[model samples]
Target: MDERSALGLLAGWVDAAGDDAAVIDGLVITTDMLHARTDFPGGTTRYTAGWRSIGASLSDVAAMGGTATAAVAAYGAPAFDAEEIAAFVDGANDVCDLTGAAYVGGDLDDHDEFTVAGTVVGRVDDPVFRHGAAPGDAVYVTGTLGRTGAAIREFERGNVERGNELFRFEPRVATGRRLAGVASAMMDSSDGLARSLHQLAAASDCGFAVEWDRLPVDRAVDAVADDDAARRELSTFFGEDFELVFTGPRAAVESTRGALGAPITRIGRVTDDGVLADGDPLPDRGYSH
Candidate 1:
């Protein structure tokens, strides 16, 4: 079975196991794993790798509307270089600092390839969930999309520095917390917008009517994509943007639009059934490993 099926199996025994993070007694906890081959692109620095790896787990905490307290990583490499190890730690600490958390320390080991497993602990009085959306709620997405796609293109063109910079994204910890106050349902778009929407729909037992023109396509995407179709494909399916996609009552959404620090666009509205883009069915496609 695939990862989703495996998670489903686990959900049968563990309550709240299907969410971005598991919450117990007001503590939010999550973990994530990354590989050098699939996650960190060629020319990616050890520093960027550390940030991306640990930031992923922090994103899970953000999805739960929790304040990250601390983080740790299990790092394994074929052979550890002292300089590289230090750079990794610096990157992890920087990301945690930006998101109001601390990276205490973690384990190290020798392995065939560079790998990182990150765990984050957070706290929240009321955590949001993916299963709480309802029809008529407005669907919102923070920040622009297709940054990772743009970064990949840059990497292909030998713009390693720019590519690495793009790959290093701040986990939307603050944005998620803000939305938590207003969002009925929420999730991170690390698995691509289309797949994220599908997952949210399945969990909430609802659908979405998304307007294609409403998508907040990143400007960098225009530099890499050849045409409108290419732009839409990259922005919607490429994933790795690390932005929050959430839903809330129309009234609540409109009221809080101006106050949110990040730029969030109202791209759609929740519906009774079927994910749609401009009235057409949107394919459930996204990043999967």
Candidate 2:
């Protein structure tokens, strides 16, 4: 199946069963586990990687419109060292407390590579779904785009240390909450911006026009990628910029921006067909998992 279709399949399951809330409230999973067998600061081989995984997943869950009420997780270890496992447990609970998501339950397994997976449960009053956009609607994105991608690029080049904004993006839980009525369709851009836009456009059965010149590049990123041409180049296919993208009528667009109180950039317009920039096709994948 195509990438978009895969995501749609998952979303379909949610929609078919997600009968709890309206435009803003429903049963939603906030986070997914993230891990690093190497390059993690707490000693790559340490148990903290699992903790990072849980944090990353929780971030995903909280980014959507939910309170991150509870979580279920399973952990895999190579040797199951007592100390290492204990540390992993500590990491998990710490994140649970940190994010206000209750630690419901999880399992541990014996394995080679470290692995952690979490399922987060939360609620929304009137849920903002992945489908439904109209032609002539404006597209809005919270915060800046291309920061995570830029951070990855810089990290790869040995440019910065940990704790960079691009590498670790806090979920836009509040923005997602305020977006319900204002946004016709809403989704988190965990994938590249280009791919997420495609998902939103196809779901709404509409088209898009990206203003390549103003993609909200970060300051340090702009200094290096430095120009519209460069930002356009990086923002296209770079992945993991977990920002939020939504679409709505002109009025809804304004209200979302105003209510969210975040820098919402009008990157494009919803169209009658598919993607278009200045009436042309957008190149590259932006962020695809």
Candidate 3:
């Protein structure tokens, strides 16, 4: 079964079934695992891997509109390289620093492949959820899209410098906090904007109508693809951006954007109808693993 299906089978026993993180007595907890062979690219550094692995779990806390408190990781490798291991720890600490969390250290083990499993703990006063959206809510996204997709393409093409932009994503923790009071529903776009919207719709029991022209396609995509359609595909369907996709009243969303001084873009509106792109149906496309 897919992750979602597996989780669904056990949903009845959990306090929160479909959110990015689980909450218990105000504490938010989440975990993520990464395999070096599959997740790390040729040019990816140990530091980046460690950072991304820890950041992935922290991003779930952000999705819940929580402040990170602490994180721990489980690292496994065939053999230890002192320098690389130090770099990995440094990277993990760096991400924890960015998210205002502490790295409390973790366990190490020997394995045939390199793996990192990171878990983060956090707290939220009023946690935002994926199921609270209602008809007429305004859909918004923070930062530009397609950066990750473009970055990966650039890396494959041997442009490491440019590709690094997408490889290192900034989790929208601050933005998520700022939006907690206003957003009716919230989630991070680690699964691509289109898929995120679909997931939100499923959770909220509503629909979204996105305006193609309003999508904040990352400028970096221009370097990767020449055609507008291809650019749109990458921006909308490729995952790993770690940006926030949320919904709220139009006024509240606008005010929050102004107050936070962050790049929040209005992409669409929630409705009773199913998801659409400029009035047409938006295809279900994104990263699935």
Q: How does each model score on lDDT?
A: 0.91, 0.63, 0.87
lDDT tens digits by residue: candidate 1, 149-252 = 89999998999999989888889898788778789999999999999999999999999999999999999899999998889888999898888999999888
Q: Is candidate 1 or candidate 2 better by TM-score?
A: 1
Give the Cα RMSD of candidate 3.
1.5
Over 12-51, each residue of candidate 2 has an lDDT whose tens digit, in order, gives 7665322112223456654454444432432233334544
- Total backbone clashes of candidate 3, pairs 3 or more residues apart or in separate chains: 0
Q: By TM-score, how accurate is candidate 3?
A: 0.95
Question: TM-score of every model?
Answer: 0.97, 0.77, 0.95
RMSD of 2: 4.4
The deviation in Å at residue 219 for candidate 1 is 1.1
